[model samples]
Every structure is written in C-alpha cells, then in structure tokens.
Target: MTHIDDEPGTVSEPPRGGRGRRTALIAVAVVVVAAVAVVGALGLGGGGDEGPGAPPRAGSLVPVTRATLTERTEVDGQLGYGAEIPLPVKATGTVTWLPEAGTRAKRGDTLLRVDDRPVVLLYGSLPMYRDLGLTARAPGGAGDAPSGGGTGTGDGGTAAGGGTGAGAAGAAEGAAAPGARTADGGTGKAAAANPSASPAPTGAGTTAATALKGMDVLQFETNLAALGYTGFTVDEEFTARTADAVKRWQKSLGVPETGTVGIGDVIYSAGKVRIGRPGVRLGQAVGENALTYTGTARKVVVNASAAGASWAVRGTAVRVRLPDGTSVKGEVASVGRQATAPEGGSGEDGAGEGAATLPVTVTIRDQKSVGRLESGPVTVEYVGREVKDVLTVPVAALVALAEGGHGLETADGGFVAVKTGLFADGRVEVSGSAVRAGLKVRIPE
Candidate 1:
C-alpha cells in the first residue's frame, strides 16, 4: 500500500474502497504485527540511553500527510420504475380488452378497450372533463354551455335570427319600458325616465362564436393535431374544426364519428408508459381503477431513515454501486414527505421495530450506465463530510494524554499535543505548534 506523509507527527490511511475495505483491514493487521515486533526489540534495549525529555519507544512509526479527507455513507437502494400509479377509468362500459402487463404505450396508442371502443393514451397534464362539441348562441336554445357561462356555435359564424329577432325584441322592450334602448345605438324614452338604469349590452343579439374552452381542450387539440389531423387551431377553445378533426381520429379507431369526444375517449399521462397488470378482468364492468402504469425510464428508490435523510435532498449528486462492483452517477429526483414504518423485522439501522423511513428517488444521469441490469438491489453512496488541505493521520496514531488532551509521539520519542478536527475513512485531521510535515508518529500496539 502507498503511504502519505505531509505532517511529521501522524500516519494516515487513504479513503476506503467499495470492495477493498476488507483488504485494507487485513493490511492494518499486518502493520500492527510488524509494529509490535519493532517495539519488542526497542524494549530489549535496541535503543539505549534515552534522553530526559524523550519518552519510551512505542510501536512502529509512520509520517503524517496533508491531504483532502472525505467521509462517505452507503445506503441500500432498489432499481426499477420509480413508482406505479393506478389508472382510473371514467367511462361507463364493459371492459372488453386490456393490454398485457409490461406492454409499452405512447401518445395516441390504445390503452384499453371499453364497449369495443379504444381508450387512447395522450401526453398531457389535464384530464378530460367534458364532451368537446359545439354550442348554439341562441338564447335558451339547444346549446352545450352549462348555466352561467359563455355560449356560442362552433362554426365561428353568426347565429340564425340574430338580426330580425333581436330587432323585434328590442323594439318591443323599448315600447313596454320608456328607459330601454332599441337595437339601434339611440337611447329610448325609458332611459330618460330612469337615468340610473344600466342599458342592456348593445351586442346581446350577436354572441361571439366560441366552443368549450379550457386547458384540457388545448391539450386534446394539441395531441389531436400532433397525430397528423389538421384544420383545427391548437388552443383552449375546441371549435367546429376541432370537432371535425376528432371525428376523423375516431374514424381511424373504428369508433362512432359523432363530432364530440366524451370524457372517457382518452387518457392523459406525462409521457410514454409501461403498463402494469390490469386490476379488472375482461368482460367485467369498468370500475374506478382499471389498471396501472409507470414511466418507461428505470430509477433507483431508497427507503431512507427519516432521522438521517438530510442527504436525500433533491438534485443531490450520488454514486450507485452496482452488484457487479461498478458504479454509476445519479442525482436525487425526488424525496417523499410522508414517513412510514417498516413492515416487519429489523431495518438498515438494525432497529427492530417502529423505525420510520421516507422514500427517495434517484435518477441515473445516463440511461445505459447500469448496463443490462433491469431491476435489482444496489448501493447508493453519498459524501457525508469533507475537509481539504489539512494534516491527517491514521486514526491509530493519536494517543490520549494524561493531561486531559490528545498527543502524537514522534520518532525521537518526543510527544506533541495536538487538536483533532475531522475523522474520516480511518484517518483524522490533527494540528499543533510542534507538528509539521515529515513528523513521524507512533502507532499504539
């Protein structure tokens, strides 16, 4: 093994390796044996005539070194799709078909078949909440708008009877009430009689042509447009052109070409999904939860102890030690807020019961870094502490002084009191007035 010597009064070991920790321990044992032999010779008068200020010889000696010290902690983690989310069904029908477990589906792909119609997948954050169709602008007419909301036709054109009907109604109201205004811009006698009354909006006869509008509409139109259909603007309003595009999409899926899309016609997710086992059987009525899915990418998850979870912050860089003795770089993707107790038995900390843990998600930076491994237990390593440009020695070098402090013994049998800083990887930082580079320190046998 290589030795580091920067401080005169200490000996330090290098950082421990993933697989070489056992080997490092064995080497320490060998060094102890050799030191004992050297001390035995010194005790047998190998060094004669000790000076007044010099102490008796100890074990073998090693020089101290100034180097960067880092402490690392390793935790157990499992590699797989981060988490599975249940896919709820909103359509009312019999479940005719379901994809096999582990099947992958992307945008516009069929996720499940209900009543012999496909429930397609789409990439979006909004859920479908209403049927995307036209609404008539006529007052109390056959319209799709709900109560207390904007109403219009999907064709972006004026409503029928908007001219003559509105003029007749205005004329009748102006005659009945002296202050009301007619269809024309001039105010009627009713307005002079009641100056405080607010005039009815002039454009009430002609409503702005619009359709069902919401972020969901925009998401649907975007996905529909992306699937090669055209003529509809991708926006929050689903207009006549959007309904026509939906019909074309429905035709391709062999579904009814009704110019409306029901809430159950599509499912939205973040991106491509890998299907889990179906929760309901074929021919059964669709229930609240029909199946499950997860993102296509693999990730590492750790059930870290809540008490020691400071390192589990999101975006923190980490190293994953694979079973094959190799390592890959990753970062914390998420950290769960809720804590849960272990199911049974001891946990990683050897706590027998009632140990709570929070879930942590780690994302590998490179997709192919883990090689062919799909899902398995792995080790995640995090740096616990670090100190740079400090004089360090093996933890075995320091000795307790009778004066209520710590000191290191030099090769000349002189003792130098020192202050300790950080202890990491079997080495420690030490400093004192007399301690300097190349000062040899004794290891206790």
Candidate 2:
C-alpha cells in the first residue's frame, strides 16, 4: 500500500555552479525521482485492487457535516469597575470625612463630609456650578418687568407664583440674583439674554441678581422629587415650593434649612458609584482632586488593537473567560472613539509594542454572575464573523486542483469541485452541487 505523506508535486532546487555535464545528469535524476514520487502519491504506481480515481490506500476518510462556523478573537482584559474617574471637590472646605475605597454610594447618599457638612451625590450629567434658590418676586408688574414667572405648580395644579410660562419663569428667576427682585417679578429680559452671567442692572433702578437655573435645576428637582420630597412640581425653575422641599430635605440631612442648594452641596453622577480612595487625608484641606469614583457594576476593559477594533462595536455580544475557567455572557458597552498608543512606546503582553489600541468596555449581563471577583485579568472573546448551517469538511480533505481552486474526493473515488467559504477550527466551509452532509471525503495521511 502506498501512503502520501508529502504533497504530490514536483520539487525543484536552485541551480548549482559545477561541471555542466554532471549538473545536467543530476538534474535529470532529480526529475525522475520526483516523477516516481508523484506517481506513488497519486496511488497509480502501487499494485492495488483500486481504480484510477481511487485515493492512496493509506488516506483517511471523513464525512462532510453541516455546522455553524464562527470566527472569534480572544483578547486579554481587566475585570474591574470600568475606569476610575476623578471627582474634584469644587467647594472650599477641609475634608472632615471620607469613604473607604471600594465602598458603593448611590444617588441621595452622602459621598463624603466637608467641614462636618455632608456632600450628597445626585444623578445628572451637568455639574453643580452655582447656587440654586428662589429669587424674590416683585408684587406686581412695575416698569419693564423681566416678564418671567415660576411655571412650577405647587401642591395643587395652580402655577407656583408669578404668572409666567413654566420654561420661561424658571429661566428668568434663575437669571436674577437672590433678594434682588426685578420689576417683572425676577424674570429679567437681560437675564434671559445671558443665563450664565448675572443679570445686569436696568434703567428701572433695580439691581439684577443671579440665581441658579437651566437644566441643572431640572436635574436637581428630579432627584429631589425621587427622594420623596413632594408638593412641588419638578421643573427647571426653583420656586418657593421647591425651596420649601429643599428645607425639608436639609432638615432630614441634619443641616441648616437655608432653603437653597449652594455650590458643592451636592455632586452629580449618572447613577450608583463605587467609591475610590480619597486624595486628601482627614482634616486636610480638600483640593480639586479630593476623591475618585467609578460605576458600581463590574465590567471588563480591553485595550484592543485599533486596527482590529471593528469587532468592538457597542452592543456586540461577547463572552468573558474568567480566571476560574468559567465564562459569562457580556456585551460591548463602549468603544473609545480615539486610538492611543501605550505610554513609553511599548505595550503590555496583550498589546504589542508601539501598537495603537482602542479602549473597549464590556458589561456582564448578570452582575452576580461574576461571583466575587472584583478585579483581575480576564479574556474576552469577540465574534468576528459567523456563518450558520453550512456544509463543512476537514481542511485536510481539500485537494488542490491543477487548474485552480479545490476539490473533494468522494467515497466512490469521484472528484467534486467545491467553493471554499469561511475557515474555522480545523474545518473549511464548502459548497457545491455534489457536496452535502454525510458525504464521505478522503484526506491523505
């Protein structure tokens, strides 16, 4: 029986400088040996009870099967609370208390205490940059009133106070400063023109005041209402009713009922947070970088190659291999828009040196599925490509045809030309009129 170990093809060597006659003889001998080897490999030179189209006697046969093919890429990742974000304390005070690292804090919870006063955490996108309070309103329209009123409804459906639209009233009041009432009940046209800056003095001899307003006001109001402070409609305007609720909330916190929210009184985050270490020590002056924080949920961060980040699209389903040899379902939460090279021009083992990488964040489907792992190295598998219910055969079963492309040898010694598709594992996707599941194919040993 003849076995085909090497491929059945001609082997050529580069020309050598020597005697012309000897070189020619050696070349002829090499060609003869190559031809004999090809004949044996093709099962034509062996004496066997096989037909001309039969594969070598020692070749193995495998049946073609249908299966789902997926191309996956695994990359090293870190399991932790995503990324640490710096939380700078904008308020001027000495740090009286700080939460221990890895402690979780949620909305309406005191993250830390400054000067014995608690700095609460709220949910919002905008940061608290100014004080929020209800500005004094003029009794009636006198002179050119700012034309703004509190549209916020009190315990009843009635408007909170001054007759003005909800959106416009809060904005106008926010533009003016506390105590400085405008002729038009705190809604100054000048304030509306520039809400960020304090309202300018008008010819009516009224001093313009600055009160906190805008979406930030609305965000705080939303949080306040969520915390069970009722009797005030949640709106952008901080009306008298809103101030009353604020006082109640302050009383609950054991703080003075100032009826106003001062800057640094509350910090805004998206949702729940896991507290990091405090930059300042106890009784130390709180600088801008007083503390750090991160999302409470567990996540895996992967620094994927920028060139191969196409599979890191947000919402893409993935699998995370844990250190315990277990895997959990996950999905891509975010992909960095910019690619950055590793610092010092060299990357870690996962990322090659000098390669630009895009940060990819993956969130586990079930928070409790991760067990007790807080932070460690992990492996994330991303599916790069997928093909379902396709006929496939061992890659070794493919035979290179002299013309071009590939063919498969059937059990009956018939050759079926096939078109190759996705290659995964040790199998190659095959399609042809004659290729079907359960069809046996020959693979040379």
* C-alpha TM-score for every candidate: 0.65, 0.64
lDDT of 1: 0.71
Q: Which model scores highest in TM-score?
A: 1
Encode model 2's per-residue lDDT on 59-151: one tens digit a residue.
678889998877666899999986678885677788898999999998899988998999999998899988899665343334323433332
lDDT (tens digit, per residue) of candidate 1 on 23-54: 45435444553443343234322122232333
The TM-score of candidate 1 is 0.65
C-alpha lDDT score of every prediction, in listed order? 0.71, 0.71
Count of backbone collisions in candidate 2: 7
